[model samples]
Target: MKKLFILSLLVLASCSPKELTEQERWEKHAENTEIIRDDFGVPHIYGKTDADAVFGLLYAQAEDDFNRVERNYIWAIGRLAEVEGEKSLYSDLRARLYMTEDEAKENFEKSPEWLQKLCVAFADGLNYYLETHPEVKPKLITHFEPWMTMYFSEGSIGGDIERVSTRKIKDFYEPNNQLAVSQGLIRTSDNEPRGSNGFAIAGSKTKSGNAMLLINPHTSFFFRGEVHMVSEEGLNAYGAVTWGQFFVYQGFNEKTGWMHTSTGTDIIDEFEETIVKDGSKTSYKYGDEIRPMDSIEVSLKYKSGDDFKEKSFMTYRTHHGPITHANGDKWVTTALMWSPVKALEQSFTRTKKSNHKEFYEMMDIRTNSSNNTVYADADGTIAYYHGNFIPKRDVAFDYTKPVDGSNPKTDWQGLHALEDNILVLNPPNGWIQNCNSTPFTSALEYSPKKEEYPAYMHSFPENYRGIHAIPLLTEATDLTLDSLIDLAYDPYLPGAEVLITGLLEAAKVAPVETNVAKEAIELLKKWDFKVSESSVGMTLAQFYINTYYRSGKIPNMVGNKRISRLGRFEYMSKTASPTERLAIFQQSLEQLKEDFGSWKTAWGEFNRYQRNDGEIEQDFDDAKPSIPVGMASSSWGALASFGTRFGKDTKRQYGTSGNSFVAVVEFGDKVKAKSMLAGGQSGDVNSPHFSDQSQRYADKQFKDVAFYREDVLKRAKSTYHPGEKNK
Candidate 1:
């Protein structure tokens, strides 16, 4: 048996094929250009035209995180297995299932002209960087097509980015049983979600009397922040850019600004496969003849040391979407087509748009993935809209999951007419806010009527935030920056009016123990149904609730009257009695004392966004306090697990992931406005400006960005290209 095994291994090794060397891929993308690295490392491209700025942007991003960005696109092309091995097999198939090369190409053509220019410019920018920087080796990809941007579309990364979705998740090793998940018809549990918070106090509402936009987007540290790209051709904006992306997907220029928060609305769906007939060689099925089962095999490359393997996978689908998961204990397939490329084009052009008419035209495209975008500008205009390219199905099938391919009724009836599904022009309230909540609650009394739309539209994330935002916005007769700030930081809703009124009643009955539960009960009792930072009860209340909140528990809806009635708002029924609540509080205090050797601790002490580089020495004291920067906790309370840390010195749990790039834009009032990027102005360590903003960022501070030529000239440390650096 051992001899036979050895022989089998020998034969396998002999049959294995060699994969491309890292150098080989690098050679394919090599280009040349003059690069000047300013002392701060913010590249100042001197290209002959707009494309130069793009090329410079790509090269600069490559310098910082080429590996991660390249990997991002590798997965986009449905070739993740080439680099990640067996673990990525399903992800590749999922990509192919949802999106295709031909589909992407076709969609690219359909994309708007300005959007295509930016993409093409982006490709040129990358090509320029490669030409100038032959020393940098591309791990897998050396060339990028215009449509490659579609593969790495901002939505594709939810497979990894801010929010994790159920759409493309791989079956983790264990099969035959369901893996644990935050299951729901609608997930309204984004209190600790990954998001950003922004509010515009229009000239009508602000002391400045100039429209003020708080362009704050919460994403990962060291992740992409705002980049000011300028071309005499009238291209300039502020917002997040993932490495090589040519334009800001979410942000503001002078005339208007925008913010995007994820929505649970089903923008993508999957369909099951049916067999009408089997043919020799290649198989073709009927679409109406018997309801066709669209299937395609995704071929992937896998490298195992000296050898490479090709992986072929079958993805099945109907007209609606791809069949991602297994169907009836058999292999199934799904098709995906978000056409985000169209949206990307819209975003690129809209950023430069000078008026609302153009903004409305851009909004008409509605090719965006699952997020609601809120807009504000100097024109005294503020708005929010939802529903991006939803597939109009047969209306008889469930769009939430895999539909039957055998049933002809499951076929999509083209896309919904943009106007039929467009939910905008919300009125009454002058502003709109979305903390990853339902789009219907975007504004106050003026929000879109639920009855006006169909049930198929994603009506929720019927979350506490939106529930909280509504009363907060409506109840205020007069709105201001101060009021907006207070609302963004508001604590939980009122106990008296909430679903757990019964739980509070129950809390009154439990056997009492320590002050921990007592304090929690006391806060809950006196709670004003608000999250204001100064609320005396809110601090203790949030802490206590944090302890009681479990991730996987079904929601408590009975006491949810203060908010919208949701599917699983029943968790309130499980609330502890006052005595029991007191016990929890006392236990918490005691645990903290034991853990830190003292109970006296500030909220900042526990929750920190600690940057753990693994190089910082372990200190037992206030040694590694996470650099405090960005918005406060509970303000943009998303992705609850993210928090500031005290590092090893003062160990404690805290959350952070908001306002990485915060700007206070007073439109037209000043050429330069207040802005800040977390960490520092320089991404490179060699520069003295590295992390210059860390201290200010920790303090929620701002710096004046160079909006004019003189301002940039005064502060501009160094300028360079992405290619070969010429000192």
Candidate 2:
């Protein structure tokens, strides 16, 4: 009987199929996945499983912009110096200071089985792309790994770590004795406000009697790619995905949609540690009982001509966090949310949620530390979470600056509960909007009361974009997708209303000498404060405000509170002398004339949109042909923000950021939507899609989003598996 059983076991073992290699397994996943490229070159990926869908999503992203995909991972994984040389050494160091490669791998190992599979797919997809495309050369990361996703779990551009200055890190760690660390915020003329505009309207305000959502992420142009990822395992999501990230950072599934705006809620904190080193061992003072500080040796590599060089540093950390910089004589530890596993899970599971309840439960994960979510669903629900992953701190302690690390009371008790956080659930006003502004004014009368929440719960003062969105939404009636688009691109610059009017009033009080100034004032006097291509008033206003930001003496501070951009306008109106105002105005005109040969250049002629090449950092040439853009900066209260910059030796300002990906969705029996991209889906300059949507973007003409498979097939320009030839 034993011999017969052994013979049967051997027979069963012999019948079992051979184990698959990594390449073979990837090929199998590719077989299960199908990518349909629409006429606009947006990839609509269909897969048999969630992992397969993720695999194809990353593969499609690589096909579109592998340079950006690999570069994102290289920067995230703390190896950018290996490509960019010594200049990026501190950036790599900052990444390692927060989370090392071993720690990232540990995070991947600690993740749940389902999440682990997704991470594996994320790596496999990129690796397979490298394997199939031999012509493509990577700058740093030759091979991808599942653990690399841990470094870039959250999709917010520049993430929380970017707030920690690399200069500060270098001064603290660099061996050079002359290194200087500048403390406090260095105020400068930012290109435009770094944020997004998300508006959710309930059924009461929409024409379809269904909820509506606007996904408008104001990011660096070409920062994200538009995609539609579908899987049989209940993973159908469509929206803008940050390059190389496996999940859609901001998008909607069929039944629900979510938009993320950069949150002002304080998530990163600095703890001033009192160091007490005894011989080689290091310790820190913590309420008299000294606790030993954690120490680790970090090794980093950088490119030196054709060869690579290595540098090592011994890093210190306290219970609070890693010692990032020094304050006076004390080493400061920067504490922030670093839960990679939970953050990745939250980011992925958020797209699969079907209704309000599921979304609310998902929000309970509380790992999204840098964004405030505005939500709408097919179930007639509209909601807003002011900020998630807020830590419960003692109200007695001020957290705006570096706090005493020795004081035990300053330690975070725990995270605030989902219900305890500031939120708006189907407000009576039927609308919710967050332009990276104060949540207390999210829904006017229905908005959350500021006093009801902790001081740390909300920090952002109201901005011009929020100021612009309020009145439009207050009177919004029977809203549709196109109407929402119209509202978002209203062209009225609320920011210009105050600054331009104030300047004109100043001119009325004290007349300026120059004829150009008088002509500019007359042009402004007739202006409706609406930005457009043909409007010369827009050109003058944009140049003038930019000049003021650079040269004006208006203090950024008013009493104890820091003045916002809108507040600066108030100060310029009430404080700046008429002489100073006219002087600044004259400077602006002279500057414009110097650049364009005429101060009266139309906005379109001055403010242009050009895509010269696929380089991450573009070089603008005045000689190149470019299209005129009607959009203005969000600083001027234009909801359709077009943050532009004048390249060296170039007269025209080309947009670099703002309104990278904008979408409006109306949820009902079937989802209805329209979307726009800054340039187009492909990053290769030779690809037709590289500049296909640039004209449409400038014209505010959004194309229909094909969410369903039938619609996708109808618009399909090409179709293929991940590793197959296009058909």
Candidate 3:
């Protein structure tokens, strides 16, 4: 038996391609690419061709954080269950529902020759990294294939497919199960708002007469790495690339810059399918005809104990899409845009666009389904696209919820044209800003009129950040890169102005006032509605607002029905009872005293920025040394958002998300930019690059980006090929 097993292993080894060894292939690729590490440890990759640039980009990504690269792919390709166990099985199923392994491979085969080359290079780059670094062990994927790139084509952290509910999937798949209501799911208007801020200023508003862009992505810390990729084939792009992705998700070329903010457009929709079963056959009603539903068996592997286990599920799909779950008695299927090949092409092509015309032509692809784009070019053109891939639906059926799948009238009537979609091009105000807000207010008088667009196009509420940004951009005349950076990090918390003033009024009207409450009110009264590390007023305001949310002092605003943060503040200020307002303030004061030994604690003492390790989901410790971060959450209207989440026993609020990668770019005859990452490029704790920029990030101090090769070499700390070790 041992001899037979050895012979089988030998046969398997011999069956592998023998044209060139994996090591030799890696050496060849390394020769085609060179990676220059700057003083701050950002990789500036130079390659002979576009494919070679992608290869070098992936190779550099692996060196910086192979763990994240592997983890992202593991989750993307529906193999997360094999590593995380049974609880993640639904997530895997959700991925497979939209695109199966066979489909991904087919998609790869159907890609254009140029894109195919990039795909092959992507796999080759990562595979070479794994082959050369024998010490780095991948949890699941040992060898990457070209097809795997299809699963994670676009750069958004969670793509449109993530809108499907895993809990609903579990309810439908499991036997004799009651549907579970998803609790604690974060919504757009949640206390910690998760999104990006993009500001595009044309030449008219800038001091240097050059269009400027603010690329501030509010994602979890270390979610993306900052890199500069250059190729002889005109692939010179610099900015943030999501870990494991070859393309720069948010960045700029020589003449243009683009930033993406999550759009509130109704793109993903659920359809209530009328399912019918006859004996062993199942069909769904479509119009007046009955169409047989597609059924497939999906086998999943999960880690159990010391061994691997398997679970097989029979999945069903309808014409609308995959039957994700049941809505009451009706089977519900989710419909979302899933054009991986085109999406990948559009994502990669956008980085190379030189001007507004080229960028506008790229938007014709219409595969960017989940984001609103803010664009600026060296030609002094600034634009804002509300949403790219909007499907035209019948006005009779509301797309915000599940529509009737049986009625063909409810189906999407192809995609809307780029011109039809809500777009702002060179608004007379010379600026465009989108903080995940309605496009109607993107610019002052020149903004797109809400009444002119379809009702489905502008359902998102106007946020406090939008309200806060309008005045600043409207009054601005001479803006520079440094001034734009300062504007992005402005400390004024507009939401607090309404809520704090209400508290002051409540204090004056209090029938029974405690000395501590009066002192707190006095501090609030003197506050300028701005946040700073040492501001005691900010500390009080944060606690008071948080306590209001937790104590249920106000009515719960459920889902889309929820009002804007500014509206909520208005309600508290104008409608809430004076007694309730004072009571909420009292609770915050007491909690502050209990947590930090005093109610007069500074905001810096409670709000902190700490990074103890490189773990994807970090653990925070109050005892560990951490820097004080002055920025507050976007919920409170802080443009430079620094949101926090606390551990079970931790006292200080440690920042977990917000302001991950921030860049200010000035597009002139030569593109000049400054960027800062949350921590640094490398994720290894032992690597000096891991936490080198943590203090600078907290201070809002950005490092000048090295876009040109000459600048990169000037700041180069070490330069080498992929396989070579840097000293």
Candidate 4:
């Protein structure tokens, strides 16, 4: 009997489950998570917990374009120079100047328990992906760390950190070659405008009597991926996620939606410090005392002729901020938002908010430094927050220029309360829009008064995109999701209207030369300023505008304030001589003929969409098959912005940026939304989804978003766990 009992006890011991190891725990989490790839290759991640959802989210992101996922982290964590060589050393230095690996880890350690779990899931997801797919190769980051998320907290592409000039950082730290750092970085009209257009309409203006929101972000192609993440912990959000980020940057839930536009509000400022150098110690002058400047040593590695080389720099900082560069004889400290933990918290918590009040409280976190938020809810509320991280600076100093660090009054006096910032909540016009323009013109007459706010609070001038959106929104009534898409993708170029009238006046007075120039002028004369696939006028107008802006003769300012691209267009149209206009038109004609065989080539023939491979910096070939894109650049106020690029060997320009991820959402009892990506979801050339949406994108055809569980299951193309072979 004892022998039989011993044998039975041994059998019971073998049947009992053993405790899981850390890796096994991760595997269990993966098992608990499910990712459903919809027809469009957008991942809909469902998990038992929020952390599990995040884990599956990252794994799915890696499956789509691991190159971008790894690349973002490599760049974010100050390791790009290790792969890209000496050119990126300053970029690495700039990253290190703000936060070190230890600092990031410390920040992660200090975060709330829930946030830490999310961070852990972020790392585990990417690391598990690498483990499961041994065939995949990472450029630099083979093992992602939880702390690494600290460096890339907010979702705006590159965020405010990118605004800091790496060129200036190099000039200050590199071997002695003195050059004065310019106080103002005047962004000219020639550079492709890297801002987004956001619109929110109240139920009063919508057909379904539900608030409508347009999530139109003008970014570089493939900059962000469209995704839907859901968890049992009341987390269900659909939107675009910047590569490697765990949270959705732009998108909506059943009850609320949010869109972010790059804000021109002066969130970043510079302080000129009076340096007092003595022996090995350095001090800087402040108010009534000399304060010691903090010096930190940073060493960066760069690829050098198949080998790695190291460079060390002794970076300095003051109470104002890190010394980014030198201006004249003064060391300049750049002050911007740097609350990584709070920023990430706000970014994630924002996705879970169900109502405007919850979202409003979330905004109080105030770490969204570089974006202006356009928000809407199911309750028919439409609101706009111009800038969240506005610092309360004394009105006596011009914050636009570098101010004296010695003056205590010049320092930022904490952040402005939410009410103090430029805010529009349910304007009387029933519509709100911000296209990186002045908040004063956001909602027509209903916009916040400019005179009421401090100059630093809303310094941006009215842009072409803002001018284009206002009238359309003003006249809008009973807007449906489809009609909202139509309004967002409006082909009429208001910017072209401002410039073409001047060209017509010039043609009347200027000396007539070639018949080609006469034909171009006549095409401009009778035509409405609307862009289309077959519009030869659009081709000619775009070419003329590009040529004029490239000419560098556009006035930089009117009165004292710096002008925008639209302002530059207005300046050139009114001020340029008839001969100058005619000459520029001739130049445009000659250039057009040189590129496209004839100057009469249609806009679509010249502007194209092509994705030959999955490379981040795509190579353009004129011989390669490409889709015709009817859209024009935002620089010309074409709201359906499509910025294109040309190669040295190619004639036709291929799209590279603008309107990358677009979605129109209507919030009712259940969310109804339609979205379009620039190309498709997968970055692998072999995947069926690589260029699946390219044609649809050119046609401005958006697909329905499967937001509900039943809807997701209906359209699901493939479903699997994170490490499962079926994926």
After superposition on all CA atoms, how large is the RMSD of candidate 2? 2.5
Model 1 lDDT per residue over 501-568, tens place: 54366656665465555555565576555433244343343344454554233344436333333333
How close is every model to the real structure, measured as TM-score?
Answer: 0.76, 0.96, 0.95, 0.95
Candidate 1 global CA lDDT score: 0.54
Candidate 4, 1-727: lDDT as tens digits: 9999999999999999996665986887898899999999999999999999999999999999999898888888998888777777888888899998888999999999999999999999999999999999898888889999999999987888888998888788884735333221211112468889999999989888999999999988998999999999999999999989999999998899999998877899999999998998999999999999999999899888989999889999898889999998899999999999999999999999989999999999999999999999998899999989998899999888999999999999999999788899999889999888888989888889988888887766887888889999999999999999999999998888889998889888988689999888887887799999999999888889889879988878778967766677776688899899989989999999998889989988988999999887788888889999999899888898888778658878788889899999999988899999989998999998999999999999999999998999899889999899654
| Index of the highest-TM-score prediction | 2
lDDT scores of the candidates, listed in order: 0.54, 0.90, 0.87, 0.89
lDDT of 2 by residue, 328-425 (tens): 88999999999999999999999999999999999999999999999999998999998999999988989998999999999987899999999999
Candidate 3: the clashing residue pairs are: none
Better of 2 and 4 by TM-score: 2
